[model samples]
Target: MQTEKVTQHIINWLKNYALNARVNGFVVGVSGGVDSAVVSTLCAETGLEVLCLEMPIHQAASHVNRAQEHISQLKKRYKNVRDAKTDLTPVFEEFKTEVSLEGEQAIVDMALANTRARLRMTTLYYYAGLHKLLVAGTGNKVEDFGVGFYTKYGDGGVDLSPIADLMKSEVYKIGEYLKVPGSILKAAPTDGLFGDDRSDEDQIGASYPELEWAMQVYNEGKTEEDFTGRKQEVFKIYKRYNRANKHKMIPIPICEIPKNLK
Candidate 1:
């Protein structure tokens, strides 16, 4: 892909979108992941006000360090870029106290992880509203469309997605081009929702590259039965997630009223 052209295209698109919407700029939740790093950099390139919020809730030290490093570099490079760190750990703990943790252990743990994402989403939107900025999403094609690896009404909540069309590999390419912090580029891809070192591959059972290949083959009308061994396993994993999380990929369903009833 024309890397330079694509970079400029996304920057122009962001600038136009913000101008058309009459918003000052964008507010992105930087998670020290390639996706967010690329996105925040792209937003900064628009030369508009870019607010990078580091909202951590029991986040791993490596993740926090990488996030701060990227934000620091971004601010140094772009005069329009600024950052704010909001430690949501206390808020998260207080919330857990109010809610019943009654459920299967695994299920409860998953719910809490998603809660961390939702809290960050709320924080991003709060800043967006306060400063007349749009909430810029950092999701990529594989996570946003292929496997649905993000939380609905949480990380999935956003005013606009600048990188949703780009695959994970493509996101990394742009990250490299944008001079993203080396620490973030080298780190394992993770949601950082579980507050652990578990990577996204650990949760999905498939790496981004494997998922990207599966997404392509599946789109071209391939099925699990067509592949053998590990390919088949990856295909099945992709299909399972794509089917179960279809709700996140589609518009909210509405019950249509009958003509006579109206």
Candidate 2:
């Protein structure tokens, strides 16, 4: 489907679900990237109350600034746009000390990255509870669902995902259709976990387009086709996340009792 139509469908779905569930509004984390921008726009179009949170750590100033600009534009365009900003440096530092993390810089950086994501989720859930809102997840199919690029209990945890099926390229198209700011639509997508030198694609070692193609092939049961020349690598990444994070995606296992006993 076209990106615009996909966005409209998502907006309608969220609106109906929110109304039926008696939710007061929708809360979304705005990371100054295309996916979140598109999700925020859809939430606004649904005529539901939308809250955008800018949670930035020490290395995310550029992303935070862009996010602020996007939020300002959203306020002008949408009637019920509310925003909040919080720096996550203190929270990350406290987490590091509490966890007693002594290791390589790469390990420390990854831990800090996950900490920032969890902190943002915590803030979103706190306000969602206080205001009776549903937290809107902003992960796209190519990232969170395909390769499990998000942190398990961090960005991966949410009340609902409005754009979990769309790929990264499709997200950019939706951003354009929504008339999101050009700068935001064109900006390089990043988690802003590390400094400017770090990026999602860089860390993953594969671009979203390639990943999406592989995902499509895999979903179609064409696992043997060597589309990207990294099929084994992709499979390994997918399997590792699926195995290590099974708890995140499934119900808690419990010992089964005999039916006769009940």
Q: Write the per-residue lDDT of candidate 1 for residues 18-78, one digit (tens) a residue.
A: 9999999999999989999999999999999999999988889999999999999999999
Error of 1 at 57 (Å): 0.4
Model 1, backbone clash pairs (residues 3+ apart or across chains), number = 0
- Candidates in order have lDDT scores of 0.95, 0.80
Using all chains and alpha carbons, the TM-scores for the candidates as numbered come to 0.99, 0.88
Show model 1 residue runs off by greater than 4 Å. none
Candidate 2 structure quality by residue, lDDT tens digits, 24-118: 87988898888888888899998989999887777666687778889999999999989987777787777777786778988877777777888
Report lDDT (Cα) of residue 107, candidate 2. Answer: 83
Alpha-carbon error at 95 in model 1, in Å? 0.7
lDDT: worst 10-residue window of model 2: 221-230
Best by lDDT: 1
- Could you give me the TM-score of model 2 versus the true structure? 0.88
